[model samples]
Target: MRLTPDNDLTARAFARLDARLTRETERPVALALSGGGDSIALLRLATDWARARGRRVLALTIDHRLNVESGGWTAFAGEAARAAGANWRGLIWDGDKPQTGLTAAARAARHELIADAAREAGARVVLFAHTADDIAEADLMRAQGSTLGRVREWSPSPAWPQGRGLMLLRPLLGERRGVLRNWLAGQGADWIEDPANADPRFGRSRARQALAGAAPQAMDDARAQVGGRPTMDGEAMARVARDIGARTLAAALVCVGGGVTPPRGARLQGLTARLKAGEDFAATLCGARVEAASDGVRIMREAGELGRSGVVPLVLAPGVEAVWDGRFAFRAEQAGWSVVAARGRLASLSDADRAWINRLPAATRGAWPVLVRDAGLAPVLASEGIERRALVVERLRLALDETTHEDDLISATR
Candidate 1:
């Protein structure tokens, strides 16, 4: 048997990922489709690559209900995928409402939906169509204060799953945006232009139109950093989330074991602002239940709510998929929530607590994550009579346990 250097390297990468995913799923590959020039080019490349290898491909597109041109893109993407001759599916989802700007929330919804869809289809590899130009522009956006940069996160395309431990791959991480567009044009591929992409009124729209194509100088700078920023903005944004009082919008309950998550309201508006401003940020966290104001770069928490005259009480039940605050149908999960609920304690304790608290940069220490919980504050575990959640889970769990015991005793007496 003769194996060359190239063969060995390729075999090693595929083998590592394949082994990791073997227990979870069996499908070969999945492509995230957007019906746009960049994504279409990626789809074509991946399909050709899969065909050459005699592998199956799964194509998935998330239709974010934000743009008026949304439905058109879904159909257009489906047809294009058909032309590419790959098994494809389109997921239509209600996008997150913006706390301040619409663009940031919508993109978060899109990526999350894509992740879930890929998992459901049992696809081993979830390929994203982000290009090198996207990476350069992302660096520029990160430098110039675009919040979407935080969510999309300047990582190279196909960021490997770090949170859920999913296997994600980005094949064209170093390919330039222009290269993809040129290739698509040559292939006579027609893609849709989301009208919203050009609207400067939206922060991301401005970044896409102005900075989507990076200059040579910026590209050089990003390369200087060596493969873009490795960190996603989820943790950073979560840190800067302002303390919206309980009356207006209940603080999002930490989902440690598995319970009910709370309402986010618009206090997250501040977190979005933090993403845009880079190091030091200033912005107001305005929602239906928050009233915070910032001074250009410094955030100050306060009290207030949007539409206060007749506030609609946001009442979400366990397991119900609904948009609370500006996010999507993100409820809580027992496994992940238990880990997330331990976020606050990471700071308070010493050595042992350090392991429990997910480590983030010092700059992002304060941002509390908006976790999804299953029931109403379930207990994952107890330690030294403490509930173990930032918001007291022991009290609730013990009370419930006591009530159950009493009921059982009464039944026995009867």
Candidate 2:
């Protein structure tokens, strides 16, 4: 294998990325910068490239609020972006932090916040600075029984609007971390190291430590062996190629079911087998209930799991949009409304609505949030907002499915 000189890696990485950007007509692209070496390099390279092309790039730093230095880091990132002649914004993950699964929660929150910002800015794509070394680390982690999948060059933003159309592009996934840092050093640029990176408590930290002595594996193009994304066909599960189909289905279930992680391998395989057998069955896996009917199989959040998941009821104070159950994205008109499961109200709908409600599996009924105002049920579903929400949800599932091929490619290289 030939080596790319440290100085040329950045340009080479961008050259690879430029081909992917040909169809991007969005005025400004969003970059998620962490003030770390990889992201800083990306910010610099992207800024220069965007400027030459007369395109705008927005560099966003997320302050996860997990450490005291987070604010300082974000501020520094903002300054770096501005100095590089790019627009900058600092997003904060402000909310009640989860006591358990903090990393996963933080990741979800981070993407949601970033996607929201990108959408607000009219940008359809967000860039991340993950590198080849990160993929190696993830590979090591997976070998050690981690289910975390390969990082793809491009994916649908796991969050709302992006699930609709916003894309997450990782331009540096083919470049090595050391090469990026070397380039940064050559430019006399400095970066901040998060203490958590060396804390050893995190799996990532352990993987990083392991990489020090691990034999280097051939780093093939991270963007190879594309597979199909997940999708439901009418009432039946869509037929996808075996290997990719399972992965796409798993991703779709996890994304739609609001699970922090994908379903276990054995269970996923079993579900796929059942789907392929064309047998009638119903089972709950990874917070989602898969029901195989004569017409088709429907994958939805299990009603019982919703309450257990501790998804608090959201009150929309007019013109505000919120994601519920991590599955449904909703926006409501001005004030006096609370969104919760249809529950008992399923019986109160008009005959037509009743028929529609009855079509939903029993276990999935409570998974749908209905609007309530003025001591009565509000016409949320009647307003066709439910259809729009469903469209977004389906789009997100397709996005995950479309990216599953990339995941397959990454896995093959590993």
Candidate 3:
């Protein structure tokens, strides 16, 4: 579509964004604002749209506090947002620089800080002012093999909100930078350029400057090919993170939640199905894409120590524990699988006995059924010791009860 050469184009853009608000965010929306010409124009047009629909908008700005003029820029942005009838807030970031390089570190801080403000405002959908030009620049940079190149189509950046919980979005990714500038000029608005934007020392500055100095028609030609396409960088990263996090959570629950340890001993073959079904991440803490063999889990860790590969035969029974390679290992559980096993009584084993069999991970500790013979315990799955295997039947029922208890807890907590 040919955008009109007037403020009406901005109005049209806002109209399109408004239509997407429900899908992008909860009813009301939060816009990442920076009082720059591009954002100012968006704010003006979005205010009109919000008013028309009886909707509300929150404008978020982040202050890195690196420059003397940062304070002034933040205040100005807040005033403009208020003028546009949108709620506004500026989040401050003042911390010692870690090991990351200057620009890389600052961009990471800014994006995460802005997301925090958006969450505080109760916004489910976050909108950023990155226009089409930004996408072209980013795509070109990635193609050129810059450090910011994405490893996968969707994977979380090392940014926050992974633990913080936020669904980031960018609908204006389709607009051209020139169109926004031209349209903002139509409305008699002005903007200040960050002095760093002209600094040639940084690659992004150099890239933006290159685009600015290029022939207008060359940029126009580039825009024709890159017309209004959205950047899936952030969104894609979020999707991968969800998958990884879920996989990790499921693996962990097997250790601590169920009244059972993961498969151990001769049954290491049994866990083959469980771990593989859960993405094989349970045994492969390295995030390996391939399936983890028995060697991987058997070499997880030795109690407080790390685990090693090779052949390690583990027996699951009373008064015994084993630490595999990583957090992944199975405890000897002949007792937990039997009936006479009491969870409270089983947990009180002596330290000397535990050290002799220390590889036991806690996830499987509760599931191993042993005869609660006075406080100290021993495995009880043999037919010779007991007159009947009624104890075995009891242990199976307890395992079912334990599974039910864990399911209830997960549903309640979730």
Scored by TM-score, the top model is 2
Query: TM-score-based ranking, best first?
Result: 2, 3, 1
* Model 2 weakest 10-residue run by lDDT: 405-414
Worst 10 residues of 3 by lDDT: 230-239
lDDT string for model 3 (166-276, tens) is 334444555667777777776677765678777888777777766663322212322122112111111000001211222232222222221122232333333334544
- Estimated TM-score for each candidate: 0.48, 0.80, 0.53
Off by over 4 Å in 2: 1-7, 22-26, 65-68, 94-106, 159-164, 213-244, 255-260, 276-279, 293-296, 307-313, 360-366, 377-380, 384-387, 391-394, 401-414
Error of 2 at 23 (Å): 7.3
Better of 1 and 2 by lDDT: 2
lDDT of 1 by residue, 376-401 (tens): 44323222311112211221222122
Which residue window of length 10 is worst by lDDT in model 1?
A: 405-414
User: How does residue 203 of candidate 2 score in lDDT?
Assistant: 94
Candidate 3 matches the true fold with a TM-score of: 0.53
* Candidate 1 global TM-score: 0.48
The count of backbone overlaps in candidate 1 is 21
